[model samples]
Target: MSENNSSQDSRSRIARRVFPDGVDPDPRFTLANERTFLSWIRTALAFIGGGIAVEAFTSEIFGSGLRATLSIVLMVIGFILAAGAAVRWHRIESAMRRKTSLPLPLIIPIVSLASALGAGLLVLVFAGLL
Candidate 1:
């Protein structure tokens, strides 16, 4: 009986978080939100894997330094994006439950970081550093 009560309470809390302000949010939306979060995680893993691939597979051909740096940076970006995605997903879900507008993430930072990485790689490749 106690276990059942605890489980029920947990479900209630989840439902409350997922349907705050009595907005009558659909259960399907919750499942979609979960899927989106999972997608972000997969994307992050791919980025990290790409980085490793560059170092492992291309190391013999392209050598090291510039290419290695690019790979590592990409991997770092992936990790950052993954973490950002998790936080954003939760925030969005909670805001939806509360019927509040979602917050804008750090788009400028993300863009600048990506641009810088790309430009650096381009310069290194053009200069024959890679």
Candidate 2:
């Protein structure tokens, strides 16, 4: 086999190993999974944008050190969310393929709590309390 074909075969083998039962899930469910993944990616991008906006627009208000720290925190959270989304997508897809119960979504609460904290910090900054 050509190198590319060999690579594809290896990947297929790995996927088959991961889902030994190898049942094809409903197309609608697969599509929904993909949509959810895309939404998470969009959310991650938004977080990154927010970080950039904070650094760009709030340096004077927050001071360079605090602004950069907040920006980094936002960006890191975005990165974590993006990675978690991929893992969640894989787990859900595998569970569906295996006719098993879906995995619990743990990222939602983390994101919610982080968002609340970030919002509170922003309020403090804007109110000159930080």
Candidate 3:
């Protein structure tokens, strides 16, 4: 019926290869989702920037080997965060289109655990225990 046609129209408007079903979501909701997506991108950039700053400014505090490892770890986390944000955005958008309950954000706990471990590593390094 008309609903099916509306779904088809929505699916065809953007990347047809992605989310091939479901009606168009409210524009306000979609814009809000996009803003959240941008926020995650900013967070990812902060992680990457922090890694660069540590590598560039901590030479006096950390040996080259330790600095390199820490820098790489932070940058890798940033990359993972950016990728996860993209996937999460798509998942949320898909759910919205389908009128389904959104999925729980799995990134929060994982990022929290990672950040705690990183902070612990920093503490150990600063205490000359690492």
Candidate 4:
């Protein structure tokens, strides 16, 4: 009985967070929110994995400083993406529950700029101009 009560309480808390106006949203919308969150998580994992692989396997190709810098940058981007995803997930869920427009995703611009810079750095490194 206690376990069931606790679980119910937990769910109620989540519902309140997601639906502050006490209106339950459609189940399909909630599932879509979950899918978006999972996609972001996969993206974050890929960024982190790419960083680790570059650092571990490309030591011979890049100078120590360049390799380390690229590795750190990729890891930092991954962390940022992960944190941003969580915030976006919550905001989207809340907006969906409230029947409001979804918030614009901020990750696209950030990732694009970062990728451009990373590519530039890689070119410089490879051309021995770094």
Candidate 5:
């Protein structure tokens, strides 16, 4: 192959593939979407770590089955969120790259649950239950 032809082939490989007769979109938008997904994954990881920390540290202080169960439940939920995040991020990224609308994740339910749990914890702490 000629030098110019080989260089063109390399460039094509480096660039994102575009589907014929599909949406005309900028590659930068796809990249930005992917970055956003990664950020969400990081946030999920932080949530998981925080939950684990709370469970591990407070278990001894609470000295009660209820406290321990609550802490473990938080940690388990965090782990579930982290796993869901990875799957959701992948789906969103894939859809964005394909020039399709991203689907909504289950974050709404998770967030609501977390908020309720947080309120319960606060109530318990204030009442000297934990």
Candidate 6:
């Protein structure tokens, strides 16, 4: 086989191994799931970026300990978010392939609460309350 065909075959094999139980889903649903996954990845990156920015720019606004803690918290949250996104994507794809009702989006409320609290902390810090 050509190199491209070989690569494609490898991907297909891996995909089949990873998604062994499900039949091929509708193309549109699959694409939408991918988009949702990408958006979660983007949110993860944003959190990581916030961590980097905090560590780089907060020397004057925050004391050393608080600064490091906030940065670590943001980055750790980012990692968790990324991991959760992968698992969620897999679960969602499996549900669709199984033709079952969609799973409840358990991540939504958790992410919303985290984002709100994080933003609130930033607001307090900037307002000289922290």
* Residue clash pairs of candidate 6: none
Which pairs clash in the backbone of model 1? none
TM-score of 1: 0.67
**Each prediction's whole-model lDDT (CA):** 0.73, 0.87, 0.86, 0.81, 0.66, 0.86
| Superposition error at 85 for model 6 (Å) | 0.8
Residue-by-residue lDDT tens digits, candidate 3, 1-130: 3667657564455555587767778999999999998998898898899899989999998999988988888888898889989989999999998999999998787689889999899789779899
Per-residue lDDT over 28-88 for candidate 2, one digit per residue giving the tens place of the 0 to 100 score: 9999999999999999989889889989998667889899999999999899899999999
Candidate 3 residues lying further than 4 Å off, grouped into runs, are 1-14
On lDDT, the candidate that comes out on top is 2
Task: Give the top-scoring candidate (TM-score).
Answer: 3
Per-model TM-score, in order, reads 0.67, 0.84, 0.87, 0.82, 0.62, 0.85
Candidate 5's C-alpha runs over 4 A off are: 1-25, 59-61
Which segments of model 4 are wrong by more than 4 Å?
1-10, 17-19
**Which model is ahead, 3 or 5, in terms of TM-score?**
3
Which wins on TM-score, candidate 2 or candidate 5? 2
Candidate 4: tens digits of C-alpha lDDT, residues 7-123: 665466666555555345698987888898889888888889988988999988987887888888898898898998888888887887678888999987887888899889878
| Total clashing pairs in model 2 | 0
Q: lDDT: which is higher, 2 or 3?
A: 2
How far off is residue 87 in model 5, in Å? 1.8
Estimate the lDDT of model 5: 0.66
TM-score, cand. 5 vs. native: 0.62
Error at 7, model 1, angstroms = 11
Deviation (Å) of 121 in candidate 5: 2.8
